[model samples]
Target: MAEARSFLQRNRIHRALSRSNLLLGGDRELVLLTALAAAILIFVVLTVYSALLGISIWIGILGALRWMAKADPLMRQVYTRHINYRHHYAPTSSPWRRP
Candidate 1:
């Protein structure tokens, strides 16, 4: 797996070479700040909705369970795919002991 990964890294040499070019200057920093602000805005909206729904332990528990049920199948599929891929390429231990 490590050997295969090294080959993938070698294929990305051109992408690595372009990292030195700072074409955005301060605009890059502004872009990052804008993205963060957008995330905070969405989070605040969700929080406001949740608060309006109710401030209660029962509501929180139900919301959590609902989200888990909604997300579980997709999460399970992703996890299974990752496990199968890893097992297919995982390195086997050598019989000889190393110092």
Candidate 2:
């Protein structure tokens, strides 16, 4: 059509598209790399958890590991070792200090 030809001539549209294509050439490779990394991470996690479940040790470890992962590892260790409900009725003492 005449309109199409005129628009192309005025804008040099084909040349612009080709230039843009050159600039955008690496987009596909980036997308492929991201997908590959995600897949690898997913596979590693699944394999480790499956192994843990098969051995039946994961249940004992899951609670402590999850809590430690959520908070500071040192603080979790301190809290678990020293906190006592039996002492609630007795005089309170600082867990960080010697009795």
Per lDDT, the best of the predicted structures is 1
- Candidates in order, TM-scores: namely 0.23, 0.24
Model 2: colliding residue pairs: none
Off by over 4 Å in 2: 1-12, 19-26, 47-99
Worst 10 residues of 2 by lDDT: 20-29
Model 1: pairs clashing at backbone N, Cα or C within 3 Å: none
Candidate 2 lDDT over 17-71, as tens digits, reads 5532211222233334544555565556678764544334433344444454445
Q: State each model's CA lDDT, in order.
A: 0.48, 0.46
lDDT string, candidate 1, 5-76, tens digits: 443433545775654222123223333454455556555768766444433533454455346445552443
Regions of candidate 1 where Cα sits further than 4 Å from its true position: 1-26, 47-99
What TM-score, to 2 decimals, does candidate 1 have? 0.23
